[model samples]
Target: MELIAKATALVGGTIAFVRRMNSPQQQAFGTAPEIPEARKQGIMTLKMPAAEGWKDGHLPTCAPGLKVNAFASGLDHPRWIKVLPNGDVLVAESKEQAGPPKTLMDHAAQATMRRVKAIGKSANRVTLWRDTDGDGTAEIREVFVENQNQPFGMELVGNRFYLGNTDGIRVFDFTVGDTALQGSGEKLVDFKPHGHWTRSLLASPDGSKIYAGVGSLSNIGDQGMEVEEGRATIWELDVASSDARIFASGLRNAVGMAWEPVTGKLWTVVNERDGLGDETPPDYLTSVVDGGFYGWPYCYWGQTVDDRVPQDAELVAKAIQPDYALGGHTASLGLCWMPEGTLPGFGDGMVIGQHGSWNRSKLSGYKLIFVPFKDGKPSGPSRDILSGFLSEDEKLAYGRPVGVVIGPDGKSLLMADDVGDIIWRVTGA
Candidate 1:
């Protein structure tokens, strides 16, 4: 017995040593290319000398004769955006960070769990702007609301505007000309904070149901929440009833969601579990089916079982894997479908916002990519529709795009860059 125990210990030590020694590239399970900082910096900072033809005129890469435009510069971490019916854009600026005292405890007997006071920060504000003239510039900049918590994701449905904050979800009736949010908003739901705090909100086409993506509280399931509850799941709530339930389970973090125009299916770009040495699990873009499991804590990306967690053979068999996987750690967000009839170049394509990476030593993603589809599904490789949002010197990024919306003209595209506080316009020449 003693000899057997010694042998087991020796084997475990060897495995641990091997894992630690493996390079980040070797640990990555998929075909994601490792983007070195030097290369990323070079690509991001590459400055193009203004050519006479390309100097100030908009060139349409997606469609002929279409022009894109930008609006409102000098924003501070602008996030989640929506286009109002009046041709104005509504943006949520998330500026607050919940600190340590609010940490949750497993049991009531644990004396360490303490309540913390809610403190307000000046950075939290919501802004609205309108491009009244068709010149692609925001002529009016107005503050819609102020003194709120960290607001991230937003959905504009009918006459109401819904916002996803760190604490929970809130909604207000939106009036076009109102300078300040007049009436008190109603709270739809509340959640215990844990894991990644960025919550993304989406609504059904008819606005009957609302969905919110909540990230896992831990790197894996080490924090001990139910595998089927709270973290890593899409919460579905009836907009009018205010009742909520789990729509889907087992996604580590889904930051972006959109409804496909042709298929009418819900698709999401998910940020997979981290700490598997940078790239074990690849980020994914897939059609999310109700009650489907995407494998968190135990497996990843369709049957690639993880070694960190305890094995569950039955659960592994039941997990529904992603349809398409993007490169790992790309930090994908904000998916929007190209509308019909504006640009031939944008026909049947999906625009995804790669928010860029932070966990790895090297950085990847910082632009908008378009994935063309055949028969209403992703067909081939995605192409860079808009690049150089981050400066040529990758070390300092000028803009980090979070949300994308098709302009009122239908020929142009509008992107919201949170870090740079600027909205960029992409139009075809």
Candidate 2:
């Protein structure tokens, strides 16, 4: 047994060394990242941290003049958050479903996700928490709705509440002060489900239209473009007529969407494709344009063609460049606008929750970041609002932040830690 253990350790060390040697040296982040030439690999790099739940006073590290605490804990895979006008917080807790592995890369990726406790049976529910006294912690916790198919996004438009489930949009009757969802929802629009299944929903300012972000069915259309029709695009749905159309296209996996108050334009954070060397193309944050394409299988970063993909010169020529880069493989997920006074010493900007990286020899993200905006555009370097999600050795992660939103009071920040199963509140020290 001792000899076998030694052999396993030696093999692991060699594999880690190989990964380090193959990883690109430079990091691609910020508005003008240096996207290097593609270095396609026969086998993709995979580095998933082991899961370790927080215990005995363990918490994330906050930036100077800020503090972090658990607002609610002991939940199950809470991935998204929505704050109601009446001060109630709703959390969407869902689990990932892994499909059968079709290739060597797929097998390795699925195995890593499973080992890190990421994929499992869907929770299929959203829970509501109330803090009536203005304290950071919740005093009331209960199920707001249940029996949904992997719900991710939630929006309340007047008396109607909309949910973005894996397969469709569901509308429920809701009141501002209500504690529980009253009935089963009505299906508003059907969405294709499977690969990259999250459907993030956003409502227009006038509440007359809804936009949904749908990811590609496979990375770079490896499963054929026929299976990718209507995927990798944002869909705009007319509320009154229930008519839906593609608002934008060619975004690989646009997850988080928000309206920039100053510009009155829609913005989104996209997760780019993997397998091209560590820094070949960076995930990005950009203002979404109506009838625009942002490049998927054919190209990236404004017509830098991906040679591996089957060529579409016309489509590549039409691909619009993203506004800013958010670091390669960072998995930057949650985004919300922060007003100037929301956090002391911080000006108006956007707060991003990065769930960390998996396909790099070294990790990136795993914290909440603030990108300062001036005159409606990113003005300076990103700052860390919260960190220390990973352990000192980087072998284990205590938590991973996903959804982010300003509390109803308009001063504090609420973040969802999916691995730790806790909602963390951030406030001025």
Candidate 3:
């Protein structure tokens, strides 16, 4: 078994190298990315940097005019962040649920994830971090909620605290100042669990509805479309009635979601499908329409048919082109609205945490980026807000960022680094 795993890893690396050599250096970003022809392989590319925690005082490299510090550390696999009304911060710390490997590729992935410390029993808890003295770092850390399914997204609307567990949305009664939840929460809505199991939650500005991002059960519905029902889409749940409906569809893994302050449109960062060329279909950032479809298995990048899934000509024609592309395999997650003046030199835009990639020869998106916006649309080139998550040779990763949220003071940004088990705070230098 060990020998087979080693061979699979070698073959995966060789495939990635060959693909990189054959493909042209095309840009996989911006309003219009150069989408190349697909280069499917029997075994997909699986290049991952071995995860290494930061040592001593090491920190991620902030872009010019910004500085970062550990807001809180020593927590279990922190993946999401939410700020409360009174400047308290909530962090959802969970890891990938373990499952038996069924194929050689699965075995290879499992081995790599184990090296990266990504495979573990989930902590299944949310921790509260308070910077009581207004310092950049949190002095108090407490487990605010515990003993739940793998929770990821969190939101508080009035006294109802909403948690997005892997299989459902749980609601708990709570007050603003309470440090811990008072009772066992009620499941407000059920969601399909496992396969791409992070359910991200975002409440409507009016507090009447909440949005949950449920990823596809399998890559391109290979597990059959029936199992994918209520998956691969953002669901809108009515807060009062607890009823839910699909808000948008065909987003393979829409993780981070935020409202664009200018036009009041919902925006999301999607992790596009892999196994295509190094930069075939780029992951995207787009304004999600109320009932829009951005082609998934049938096609990608607006009407370009994937040819892998059974053709859906009518659905392909209706696919909405994303507003902007982040890059192929960037895994852009952890989105938050950043108004002008929140960070020095950065105007109003969206901050995205690119948790990095493993399916490409050359790594992409191991950093936090900013997409400038004007009138609620992408106006300029994306810039790096924080980087140096990976070593210069790309063999070691210091951390993988996931969830990002603007601080309650509105002048700082807090990011969740799952690999480092730390919450990073960024402010003007």
Candidate 4:
């Protein structure tokens, strides 16, 4: 079985060379894709460009009047980043560990992982970078926190710093200007292990609680709904009691989230279900309502029922329509709102890092996109601001971004490029 899977991967690997895709029109970015009559979504497309590290002095394409630089490099697989109050940048160097294959599909998935070489070993640590002077780059690097269990998200509220490991949320006390955490941490909440392991976290405005986005274990409940009990939704947890409850449901994968600064509404970028052809369903960025269901396995983008999953009339009825559709299989993950008076002409909008497509015939979303927000709602089309992750030949990618955050000073943007092990800083020139 292993040998056959490996052979299949070789044939599939060659197809990665062909990634140029015929995507929908520009209107597809801000509105939902046209849902076709019910149909069984196709099998996996198995398309992906190999990660090729940047050549000497190579950088991603920046928008006009802006510039890009490697804020910090020479690290392991850094998946997420957070800017601390003290101007230190904390990066989560993590990757999913290869577990034993229990099903034939699992074996095939491992083979595909070996072929793409996209995900690397988790360093199980959060490294810190501090620019001692007023330089635009870091002057010192330290392991701010370590021995974590595939950690991804982080938030510091008052004296307690919270870190979201794949299996749990840990809290540690901290003081200003501390170089490293000294304790093992108090576990706040336990989570189901290692499917979509990135547990994205955000503290409430009042610092009384935090929200965590947990992704589904398998696409469209392929592993059965029984195992998906605590998955596919955001959870709100009380800071003092450590009590958690489901905040929203049917978000297949809420990868990045933030509070809309204007209205204090929570927003997230979701990785929608795949195999839905090239255009049937689109991933989205939307305001997450408390106790809202956005339709994951049984439906997508509001009332479009997924023909593949077991349907429930109640779930279909309760599904809330998303505000904006990004694009089909765009794999949009990272999101950060831009501050006012920082980048003129950008105005008030959110910046999202699109990790690009892996299942589409033609590639989409390999850069930073800006969606203008008016009065706390997405009011314009998402346009590319940074790009060129793909090589000219289209056979290789220099980077795939994950975490995106505005710097603490609000003057620059930081993006975590997991494939290249680099955190890119974007600033006005």
- Judged by TM-score, which candidate is best? 3
Better of 3 and 4 by lDDT: 3
Top lDDT model:
3
| Model 4 misplacement above 4 A | 1-10, 13-27, 35-42, 114-116
Residue 323's lDDT in candidate 2:
86
Residue-wise lDDT of candidate 3 within 1-429, one digit each (tens)? 456546655776777778778765765889977888787755778887878989998999999998999999998989999999999999998888868888766788877676567777899999999999997889998889999899999988999999999989999999998889988989989998988989999999999999999999888888788999988899999999999999999999999999998889999999999888678789999999998999987889998888789887899999999999988888898899999999999999999999998888888889999999998799988999999999998879899999999987889999999889999999999
> C-alpha displacement of 208 in model 2, angstroms?
1.3
- Where model 1 places Cα greater than 4 Å from the true spot, the runs are 1-69, 95-98, 101-122, 177-179, 226-228, 340-344, 390-393
Candidate 2 weakest ten by summed lDDT: 1-10
lDDT of each: 0.65, 0.86, 0.89, 0.82
- Compare candidates 2 and 4 on TM-score and give the better one: 2
TM-score of every prediction relative to native: 0.78, 0.96, 0.97, 0.94
Q: Candidate 4's residue-wise lDDT over 1-429, tens digit each?
A: 458555645655444333223334442467444654433433465656767878888889988878888889987888789888889899999888877788765665666554445444679999999988867788899998888899999999998999999997999998758889888989989999767888999999999989999999988898799999999999999997889999999999998998898899999999888775655577899999999999988998888888788899999999999988887777888988886666545778888998887666566777888888999999877767789998765568888887899976688889998878899988888
Ranking according to TM-score, highest score first: 3, 2, 4, 1
